[model samples]
Target: MRHLTVFDLDGTLVDTPRAIVETFTAAFGALGIAPPDASAIRATIGLPLGQAFGALLGLPADDELVASGVRRYQIHFKEIILPRAPELMFPGVTEGLDELRGLGITLAVATSKVHASADALLRSAGLRDLFALVVGADQVAHPKPHPESGRLILRTLGVPAESAVMVGDTVHDLHMARAAGMRSIAVTYGVHGPRELAEARPTWIADTFDDVVGLLRAAPKGLAG
Candidate 1:
């Protein structure tokens, strides 16, 4: 069977906290509301835009204020964040991805970002072509920690859950992988710290992007459990 690897975009493949923080701050300022502190915003990095805004503003996800915030965030993201895509890639990401492909392992992305934004960011960073599929929050009825995104990727890619591993930087990603009956590799360099990630019970914990590549290369098939 062909091995498959599903990755989380933000905090995993891309270092997006700075851009995300700036965009959220800009959006809240546009709404004349004080933005959440950077740490609070960072805590919500792996969630969908509505959920992130809701958590930050203490509003319901479907509230008009949250909707407005989402709109403003998108505008600022496109104007400010997208332009900096090239600088957002994590170290060793490009080389590691190339090495994974060279190993003949299929790769896909499951991100909380909206489909259009995820696609645009990856394309702008020149990493879009590396993925066989990119499933974003908008493409799923429920997002991470719910297993919808992982299941969607597996089903769409025709890869069994056991033949794949989910690599990410947040509890949401690890939980999603477990819920989907797939093994997970948690990277320590992202949103959540090692202690928090350990609570998620990933199959392995990697300290860097190169570590993730090494784990996959060392046990391309066995890592899936």
Candidate 2:
């Protein structure tokens, strides 16, 4: 049986906090509004861009100001973040992905970024071709913690919920997996701590990217469940 492993982009496969933080700062600055502190911004890493800005600015996600901020953030991200893509990836990610592919596990991405931006970042990082599909917030009716993106990926890949696993670093990812009836692996090396991730009840918790590889290797049958 074939297995599918869907990953969250920002914190799972790539360490994008610096670029994200910088872009947020720049966006707020452009709007003449003070940006949230780096830690506060980092905590919102896996959320949709507008939602993150909404939380930071204390406005609704669809507020006009928040919309403007999101647009600015995207502009800054392209100018400042995409160029740093290759260096932003975490260690062991490339090797682990290659190993998983060798094991014949299909890979896909479900991220909070807009579809175009996510695709651009992956292509810049040289990881785009590794994934069979890349689903982003714009492509779905709802974003993370809603399960629409996860369900979309499974449907697009022709994989059953039980035969796929969602690997990510946030409660949003975990909750999405649960709502979609897929297993989850939460990595502690990202924005969330073990305690926070544990609340989401992930199937496995990984301290490093290599542990993710090991978990899958030890659970070939589990992947098919």
Candidate RMSDs in Å, in order, are: 1.0, 1.0
Candidate 2 per-residue C-alpha lDDT over 1-225 given as tens digits, one digit per residue, 9 for 90 to 100: 779999999989999877889999999999999888999999889999888999998989999999999999999999998999999899999999999999999999999999999999999999999999999998988999999999999998999998899999999999999999999999998889999999999999999999999998777676655
lDDT of 1 at 107: 94
Backbone clash tally for model 1? Answer: 0
lDDT of 1 by residue, 1-225 (tens): 788989999999889888899999999999999888899999899999999999888889999999999999999989987888889899999999999999999999999999999999999888999999999999999999899999998888899988899999999999999999898899999999999999989999999999999999977657545
In candidate 1, residue 162 scores what lDDT? 88
- Once fitted onto the true fold, the runs of candidate 2 whose alpha carbons sit more than 4 angstroms away are none
Instruction: Give the 10-residue window scoring lowest on summed lDDT in candidate 1.
Output: 216-225
Model 2: ten consecutive residues of lowest lDDT? 216-225
Candidate 2 — what's its lDDT? 0.93
TM-score versus the correct structure, for each prediction: 0.97, 0.97
**Residue 169 shift from truth in candidate 2, angstroms:** 0.7
Determine the backbone clash count of candidate 2. 0
